[model samples]
Target: INIIIQNQTMIAQMPHAADLNDVMSAIEAMRIQEESSYQCPDYLSKSEEDGSALPVNEECRRKMAEWCYQVVDYCKFSRETVAIAMSLIDRYLASNQGREALANRKLFQLAAMTSLYSAVKVHEPEAMEPKTIAGLSRGAYNEDQVTAMELEVLGAIGWRMNPPTPLAFVHHCLALLPDGSMSMSDREAILEIAKFQTELAVHDYSFVHIDASKIALAAV
Candidate 1:
């Protein structure tokens, strides 16, 4: 299912992936990824099974990511939005000051919702609004709260919004293989499997700090 199925108008249009790929050189793509790769969240210092080191446990974080997935699926927003949102959440929570904030579950959920809101607002602006995101919280939060959290989260991440994604890395790596190396049918099958690994990495918290390039390489 395509995450974005917009009704285009004369004012603007979504460029096809092919249209975009044609303009960008692979060297430039890798360079951009190199610049942005440091923006990824730190390896979670604590785990659920371990004696507590941080208030934000891994399971809770995992659940938050899943909820984001559910919301994006319902809204027909790109599933990649969840990855982006979770990246924001993780980067924020991994901070010294933010460590205390994660101790509060309500604040965490509000932050979670806000992160999702921020992602959709950035990537799928027409799909949702802060008011709608607040409503989805079942009255636990209001529009003001969501908006504030969005600002706070963005501030926490130093306004570096374009985090590298595993899928993007996968695409670049796949393109490196010569077309003659594999039959079209076999190439398609391999691509599907490789893409699936990237999806799994996106959902699994252990993969958070791993480089997107590393994940992509492992996937293939």
Candidate 2:
């Protein structure tokens, strides 16, 4: 928990009216935007073992997601980056289903890496370049290929990079709790638990379509 908590010095801050208002506004916006653009493809429509129609089936999706998590973990980026990257991949795939351009495994890998690169660029303070991502690909992809795929993914998703992730909802919901309702340490403990659940949820394709707010509340 401490490792990921960022600031270990817990300065207990009380929730104010403006703070609550901002959260409420953000939550409402997230709910609206979620339905409008962020909803992922249905897990119920999972392809068969052979991945007949789509090369990027649920198994492939989970593997990519897990790989994203590994990259963020190794790079010490927020675990939420994995959630955001996965969301980008999902929303792009949802927009273009079974398209021949994305029907190849090699192309799928490019899309996955480019999604992670784009997410990091948008959300992380230290942005990762296409070449860095290419190096991580271990010669499977080159910088130019990654650069091209980044543009394709960005355009596919309408450049809406910041989707409300489960972790974001978790933090916002936790803020809504009455101040001093519990010891800061206890609150941190609960957060640690919920964070673990959300991270696991990100890896499982089953939860991709489920609303992030619902998943966050359930995890809490």
Candidate 3:
């Protein structure tokens, strides 16, 4: 209930819808730039021979994703933080060919913590300290281990931390909705629900293969 109330307050305090046009334009520019600069590596469905095999199978992947959802919620991090962390984990796993090195549960936990730490640094103003993040792991990792994993993740992804996420596309589309198409109260309600749906979609591995724009549209 507190979470819902907090979300409502945040949404109410968001900039006026008119500013969405500028946000949309900026996101579109980012999309173009990202496409030109980096190609999203095949991570989930790639053949084993491609050196991009999923370290965990489908069932394990689902469990890992659920764990991520719980951790993010417990920490009260923004939804965007979870999305960014998930992206980092996916990209790192996809690009690296060594499945044996990451097959252990401890290493995966470290990766998740490091990814969350990195995402928090980028997206949150009051960043979560390395120790706090380590504590969340129940001593599976220490502060030094978390910091080390952070550097490893950064190197693995080539320092590309700002990849476009579904929430970005969703915001862009919501901004494009026709003005006065609905009552102000109705619009706010729809936006809240759509945003909720988008957050849920992020945790579902099935949606990982879908395009961000498509997911955003479906959510809205």
Whole-model lDDT per candidate: 0.68, 0.77, 0.66
lDDT (tens digit, per residue) of candidate 2 on 135-191: 998999988898878888888888898788887777778888877889989988988
lDDT by residue (tens digit), candidate 3, 45-64: 66445564345655565566
Model 2 TM-score is 0.85
Q: If both were scored by TM-score, which would come out higher, candidate 2 or candidate 3?
A: 2
Work out the TM-score per prediction.
0.78, 0.85, 0.79
How would the candidate models be sorted by TM-score, starting from the highest? 2, 3, 1
Q: How close is candidate 3 to the true structure, as a TM-score?
A: 0.79
| Model 3 CA lDDT for position 16 | 42
**lDDT at 136, model 1:** 90
Candidate 1 residue lDDT tens string, 69-164: 888788776777777778778778776546656678888888888877776666664646677877899999987888788788888888765666
The residue ranges of model 1 lying beyond 4 angstroms of the native Cα positions read 1-37, 41-43, 46-53, 125-127
Question: In model 3, how large is the Cα lDDT of residue 26?
Answer: 66
Please state every model's RMSD to the true fold in angstroms.
5.7, 6.0, 5.8
Can you tell me which runs of candidate 3 are displaced by over 4 Å? 1-24, 33-39, 47-55, 97-102
Per-prediction tally of clashes: 0, 0, 0
